[model samples]
Target: MLHSEFYLFEEEKPLRCTVRNYQENDFQELIAIQSECFPPPFPDELWWNVEQLSSHLIHFPEGAICVEVNGELAGSLTCLRISYDPAHPHHTWEEITDNGYISTHDENGNALYVVDISIRPKFRKLGLGKLLMQNAYYVVIELGLDRLLGGGRMPGYKKYAENLSPEEYLKHALSGKLKDPVITFLLRCARTPVTILPHYLEDEESLNHAVLMEWKNPFK
Candidate 1:
C-alpha cells in the first residue's frame, strides 16, 4: 500500500502550537478565525483597528497559544480574568462589559476576559481542544485563582444554536434553554446524569430545560 493509503486510516498528529505573546499583526487573523468557528462571529473591520487592543486574544498577558500546522496558522487559545464586583480591591477584571464575570490573571496583576477560540475544522478532534483548555487551566492554577469562569463554554455557545427548533429559538436565541437540554443530553450520553445550574446564565429560557443543579458556585 502507498503511504497515501496509510494516511487514510491513520489519525493525524496533533497540531504544533507555539505558545507565544500576541503582536499587533495577529489581531485581524484572530477575529477572522473566530468568525469561522462561531455563529454570531465578530467581523474584522468593526473595531476601529485601534479597538483591537481591547481584544483579550492580543493580551493574554499571562499567556496564549497559536497552533500552526506546516507553518500555517491553525487556531488560537486565549485567557482573560474577569470580575463582577467592581468594589473588590483586587479588581483585575479585564473589562467591565457584558458577561464579564470570568477573570484571567496577567503577570502585572491585570486580568483578561476571553471568550472565543477558532480552530480549523480539519484540525479538531486531534487533542487541540484539550490542549487549549489545559493551557487556560494552567494559567488560573499558576496564578492561584480560586474562581475561573468564561462567557460561554470553551468555544462560545454558538454550535448549540445550529439547527435549533422554533420552540428552542425563543428568548436568548439558542443559548439558555437550548443549551441546557443539549448539555444535559451530552452528559447523559456519557453515562453521567444530566446536571445544570439552577438558573442558567441569567437567561429565563434556561428554566424550561435544566434542572436546578445549584444556585451558586457553592464556594463563594
Candidate 2:
C-alpha cells in the first residue's frame, strides 16, 4: 500500500493534499471522475465499475491510489504489476490490464504497469496529475520494481492524421515540433517514448493509437 500526505501552495494559500489507497467509500466519486474526464466518443462503457475497482483493492492495493486536495477527491492513478520484457513489449491496454480488472497482476513482476491516471476536470491544471504519477513512481520503488510502463494516448494525433503517420506524429511530438496532450505530459514526467501502439484503445482523438512510454526505476 502507498500513502502520502503533503501540501501545495496556490495563490499563497495552502492546499492539503493526500495520496492514499482506494477505499470502498470513494467509489461514487471515482465514477463521476470518469464521466467528467472522458466524454462522448470515449466510450462510457470503458468507465471503471465496482468489480474492477474491487479487483484492484484485492489484487494489488499498492497499485491503486487517489489524490485528495483540501479534503476533496481530485485524481487517481491505477496500476498493476507485470514482468515486462523490453524486447517484446507489444500489447493492448485491455489485454495487459485484463480489460481494467487487472486480474493479470503478477506478484513477482519486475515492472509496474499503469492502467490509468485520471484527474477531475476542475482539479486539473493544479499539477495533480503529475502528483499522481509521482506517487506511482514511489510505488515502483517501494515494490522493488524495475520501471513504470504505460500506453499514453496521443490525443492530438487526429488533427494531423490526414497529413502525418502515427510514427511521424510521435517523432514530431518528441522533437517539440508539436504538442500532444498525453505524450507531452508523459515526456514532462521524464518518461521515454518506446514506440507507437496502434489500436491501443478506442480513442478517436488518438486515432486509436497510443505511445508506449517507460520510466526506468533509477533506484533499481
**lDDT top scorer:** 2
Q: How many backbone clashes does every candidate have?
A: 8, 0
By TM-score, the best candidate is: 2
Give me candidate 1's TM-score against the actual structure: 0.50
Per-residue C-alpha lDDT of model 1 across residues 107-199, encoded as one tens digit per residue: 443333334345766766454554454455556556655433433321223344456432344333225443343333222222122122222
lDDT tens per residue, model 2, 13-36: 889999999888998889889888
Off by over 4 Å in 2: none
Write down the RMSD of all candidates, one decimal each.
10.0, 0.9
Residue 157 local lDDT, model 2: 93
Q: Indicate the TM-score of model 2.
A: 0.98
TM-score of each: 0.50, 0.98
